[model samples]
Target: MSAAPESPAERQAIDRLFNPRSIALVGATERSIWSIAANDNLRRFDFKGSIHYVNPKGGTIFGAPAATSCAAVGAPIDAALLMVPEAKMIDVFADLEAAGVGGAVILSAGFAELGENGAERQRAVAAAAKGAGIRILGPNCLGFANFVAGAPIWTTPLRRPMADARVAIVSQSGAIASQLEQFAYQQRVGVTHMISTGNEADITIADAIDYLARQPEPRAIALFLESVRDPARFAAAVQAATAAGKPVVLLKVGTSEATARAAQAHTGSLVGDDRIFDALCRKLGLSRVHSLEELIVTADLFARLGPVECEGLALTAMSGGMCEIMTDQADAEGIAIPTLADGTLKRLREALPPFATPANPLDITGAAMLQPDLIPTALAALASDASVGALGFVFDAPLKDDARGFARSFIRHIGEGFKAAGKPCVMMSHTFSAVNGEAREMTDSAGVIYSGGGVRHGVSALGHLAAHHAWRRRAAAAADNVPAAAGTTNAARPNGERDVLDYLATAGVPVIPARLARSADEAVAIALALEANVVLKIASPDIAHKTEVGGVALNLRGEAAVRNAFDTMLARVREAAPAARIDGIVVAPMRQGGVELFVGTMNDPQWGPAIAVGLGGIWVEALKDTSLRLLPIGEQDALDMLAELRGTKLLDGFRGAPAADRQALARAIVAIGQAALALGPDLVSLEINPLLVDGARVEALDGLTEWKESE
Candidate 1:
């Protein structure tokens, strides 16, 4: 279900899978584990749709009448869940498809994970599924669940389904999906859908996300993924979800070598570069979580309070110790806990005793325990503060019912007050197990989010929410102001150093003032005309690393010195790299006393044009500290990347050295991004090493450009 219509074939197939009117269990039985579990869970969950059992032996299953085959049943089946063996899977699918089944979820293993033979069988199954216009979920998958439809197709032990589902968990690993479900239920978080896109031979994770984006029941989406099969469709789905006002939280593994190899062996998925995936996530406004804890916690926050739109947070507590703990956690996570506005302080002073403090992490003291009204009054004042975008109330509670009730009363009253103001509020307990049914009910009724895990988890959730809010705004602004890269009408020819410099200069990246000279006398004349100490380097596309090839000379002060250096540089280049296609020598006036930096771009096949910035000079490789972001980024993004570097103090003039012009450097970075956008795919890669940065000036001292192809 896309905002735009899905292809007629695909749309009908997805509809049949998620909203099946009639389901036929292909390998229905009384004894097999998966079959028994499926039948028992369906009956327990009380699926409203028509259910049919098909067994070759013609035995009834779970009191449902059995049919010998799809034709014997003699009706159109919407979906079939097959628990058959690998050898019989293809034939079973063919029977269902010929019987006009719309979708199939095959729970058989031995496909892809078993190597080449299994891979070949999986391909044959996919071809048969497509030929019959059937959308298949897996040839080796654990099943899916649609809680809203009361269709728990998953074969697992059951808890009573949640009444009001809000978050959808879509994962590639069935075991992980089940683990997440159990964890969510244990934490009292409601889930709308649990989909495991195992193997994804036909229907992909992208398709599932796209379909879920149009579902009204899910307020947020949590994706547990290894890789994306279709990047374009995946990106579009993310955009659609954002536009539809649903947040997408993602947990992607495969960053390490062992994990990547494991992923390939397990699911036969290509673990693409994780760094590129990270950049893509940032570009798409996806909140990427690294662990299972983060995934559940982040999604719970989104489901409980909706999207967080504020940048600052206010923390209120009854105990000063709890407040201190929360403040420490917030600071450790880099979450902003701003001071209360003057008016907010005045209001708090009137409500609380003189011993109570009126600041962020405001400690209302034990006085609030006696005067219950003080809690709501303080919360209202803090929510009304101009600087506070969100609010959190943390209180200490024991595991006893009485303590839980007291905590509940405080939360219910605070939630009621903040509900009218319509800002997000979080009710957290000092201990994870202390938050009981009463506290959770307060959240459900009052629209306040409850984080049962202590101060650290609560603050971490708030930190992630606030960061996403800020990034979304920046992404939106960039989208409106910047144009996307256009289609290439013509290819670019391979460029030499002069061509690279000329192209960069036109794009506002300040290249050093230089001239190409074929002769030593010509190079000396160009250096003397500039009337400054000059550097000469052999200009050749083949000799990209000039210094490594002995093609560079520095600090020639006189005409004779420049002429001698030019001849020596040519001779050295010939001796070092005799086969290089030398394109003459470039002589430029020397720029001194500045920090060496690098700015680069690559038209990433998956993410598209991205810019990278780092400390340059010869140690660029040795000191691999750098930051990257997708192209068409603003000046602020460029500046933020610079500030993120570990060596930022070097740019700030460490130990009495002159501070480099960071603004100038940021502009140069932006210009590189702009050039990348303008050139599109034709500009394969561009690198400007030793981009010198002095006070209020930046220059590209040397560069290399790789083209798409010659016309």
Candidate 2:
């Protein structure tokens, strides 16, 4: 029996359809093409639940008695399938609402796809369903299936048995979802559940994921999203799935600007900023696939093979040419295949002929195909060796009758041997001839992940699988004990340089101390009091980039120099932003430090707040060498962000220069994240450019923050 549903309303809806006492098929007809196909599909599957057909002009459908309307069913309906015309969808929904329908699968297209008039009708349907507390699947969709219960409520008929499967397929495109289902059926791979979220008007992909996460059968979820409506909610769902030990493989299509615009016009969904979405996915541990085929193949492997334990890989092929090709591809893709040890090589040579070379990608010669047991023996030897964690098998077909059988036997024996020895193996099969049933059975039964197409595809899948494993390991190890604040703080205000510096100091970000002076004598006195070479700047909240306005003068060595520079800077500021209000000349002691860095934090309305750190000074924008991390980051995360910078060489003692204090830099970034979290939406932007780093300290030379009024 299927497990009890956990999501209250969602469970009620699923249970009502899968194990319902009765179901009413609205818009059912003897002449409708969908009805005829659906009726035949139901009979073929031998569904045990009570089925009632409802059609206004119905006589009978597939030998089942018909009802003039949903109310004519004369019993409480659990779920109703509305395969009606677009114009009549709302009215039929109203009738179902009046009849107290529990849930509905709307297979109508006119609601959202037919322009304004249809959109109004779609709204009406949604309003009626919400008012009646009825859960809806879609107004323009292919519907869903609950495999365990033999519940195939989809518009298209499916007759395959629901094998115990671990992967759940969810897609925004109906065609992609159907393709995945067909692919799985052809591979003899079972599907736990499949859902096509068409025109996500009411229920969304995130909601489906949140609900499906409660199911125990799906060990992984394969998602194909054309657009994302709620980025934060999607991030949260992905995080929840990760916490539950279930990986999510996602294929996000239509990322280009033109494609995004097309998606918006097609579904009325905000395509969202691509960069922010990509960053969110990385932060939340969602493995991204680039194509539909890759998504299906990777998901299937992850579901069947489970997680790979180690990064070490060993490639074994019968031909030297294939080995060379595999090696070059693996190197280009960053797949590390360690060289075999001397002892391992010696043992392999003893097992095979003296001419056999036992390198990383062991080429035991094409003659091994004649030996039949040679391939499995070599695999067994490698499996026993501690040097190899995983193995790759490349098969080249020969023009012999037993060639197919030999390949089949080799796959089965090696697959069982690897499992027994606690190792994983993937196979690459290249042949112009069509793959027969015997070859497929051997590949599947042996638990070998087969790459039936191209060598690059097989390598790419292994590389992705390895990368995912590494990502999970890093994420797990980086879990820190930083407590989140109860509420965000507010720091939005138009303040001069002094006030901005004070706020940064209060947030635990180190900044240079300075005093504001109204006149040249005051500036001279402040510079003299510090007893060091000073930097002078106009302290105006209106002039954020003071250098552009000629308001900044560095290396004011004495009182005379300070006085002269202050007067000249004041006149330049007045000339630059003539209408702007001038604050005063600010003087601060200057200290030589290594490396200029820029660190900033901003609150994105869609994906929450994020912090970025990069090479500072004029090249910050031009080079754009930066790394971003989600807000509320811990010290470790801050350090990782800094380490990821391409300009990290500047911090690592470049050209005989002393290395900058990365620890202090990390602390400053973490502080920035804390300030962002505390400031909430009231804070617009917080930037500290040209932050100086010395032996064990870092100082923010300049700081600025923009604010928004609170509701």
Candidate 3:
């Protein structure tokens, strides 16, 4: 709606398009399900706008005289739903433009989603819409609905509104939009807007998010994404939403790494499409979930509770078994279930039956079943604990005809307990179930936030709440300390391993000292100066893995051994890769025993510069256990990335070895990322393999850089 990064006037125009006062259904017919559903939804939603039916062949449609075209309507039409054939779009747009239609929803298929020819056709249609001064949503998509405004342009069976809806759903697939709406309503989670951005030829998901970010209705946004169409707009829109204090939750598919991993470095092997998106999410403060149910539950909880502000959850249940189940799941989800303070326990003990205990995940015992008021008393005491950020009670909401007898009084007291506590609290189901209207009314009357996802999904949602809160603080702090990535312009172009070390040395990154030896005599002379065992390596910009080509000879001492190895290694490399351009041998002292860390940077086609850090050597490819983040990261972000690695424990002096200096290592990782960015846009990958973290020392043992070929 607000196509942000667009002018203010343009944003207002798009906003008007989404909330149009009048509509024209161009292909309305009795035989088409789409047309029937569209009309039915408008009526059901009580949309109080003028609706016009138009067809190429004018006739009676929807019990009204249908206009032959938009021009024949003889009224200022704000928006038109074009249900005509793809081939007829050119002519139809002409008619709409002449009639001064401001926006068009192209429901016709056979556009960009079909590939080359379809893409070409879509381009033409986009041009036509632009020439007509109209904004378009999609040529292949289910239309949108604005619940707050009572507007329904959607062409699917619509559910009744949830009066106080606060979450908005945006999806790439029309079908997924429908599914999300159905699920959201089923969970008793109301939605303010539902938009399907299928084949986003004109208005993309970024435009939708940017528009929604300005609204006061939706407190949290849920995104079902297949891919990103505009990275810059997407980032800006998410930032706007974050600034608005609205959390964005994303559920995406497709994790193919084949294309991103096609390079001559280890970094490429670890970079995937989804990993890049994951890195972007971390940078943007988005809560990412994996399942459809998680997507809704997390967003719903985010909307209802906002951020938890603290890191712990206090839970209660009637049965010991249920309490155990919730605790186990909480532990699994990494949710902190803090123990109640002494004062909280004393108050709980005073109010509870003698046999009952006072603990976090406390079992209230069946005594509360008869004396229902005891439940709220226990809850109030639990909520008083300083360790509890938020509290939850596992009470399954009743279905139809079940909200009678003791249940009514029980729910009322639970509501009283929630109010008296004055904390963010929720009533969760013991098992996954839907909230019927009667149950919904019962909870709403008590002012209780409820989730039918029950224990598993509900606990996971709490975990997300805490995690997102923590991320926001970290992201805020990180913003202040991000180091600038300006590289020296006069620095020599790094063509090989030796040149890369020279470049890194300028940035305070310690590198293994080395010298170029053009001949056997030069190799022996370089070895004599080192005063220790030296290693000889072929220095060629064209060669990457030196071991495979026999271009590396490690731990050689004395003039005889150094001279023989340099001459023999060159011969071997020539036989293996004859066309490679050799820049002579690199002779350096051979040091032993250190933690091998792999730090690499990649220029992603979609996410831009990013870096990966993990255990180096064979473990890099064999374990494939690495952590990634978008580049230009602060030292704390780099530290967080290292902490996320599975083999991170090895850095703490494993098996009686020297413990690596993590702060020093983190700075090194950040420096490498900055260096990679400074190499400019032509860089494909910059790698520091086996970074050699020995004791308190960290140095770059070897370095490599790959560049894009000049076209």
Name the weakest run of 10 consecutive residues (lDDT summed) in model 2: 262-271
lDDT of each: 0.78, 0.72, 0.86
Report clashes for each candidate as comma-separated counts. Answer: 0, 3, 0
List residue ranges in candidate 3 displaced over 4 A.
Answer: 1-4, 256-265, 318-387, 401-404, 485-492, 557-561
Whose lDDT is greatest here? Answer: 3
Give the alpha carbon lDDT tens digit for every residue of 163-221 in model 3. Answer: 88999999999899999999998988899999888899888898889899999999999
Model 2 compared with the native: what TM-score?
A: 0.85
TM-score per candidate: 0.90, 0.85, 0.93
CA RMSD, predictions in order: 4.4, 5.2, 2.9
lDDT sort, best first? 3, 1, 2
* Residue pairs in candidate 3 whose N, alpha carbon or C atoms collide under 3 angstroms: none
Write candidate 2's Cα lDDT for 529-632 as tens digits.
99999999888877777889998898878878998998899888899899877879888988775788887776555566667788877767677777776666
TM-score of 1: 0.90
Ten contiguous residues minimizing lDDT sum, candidate 1: 262-271
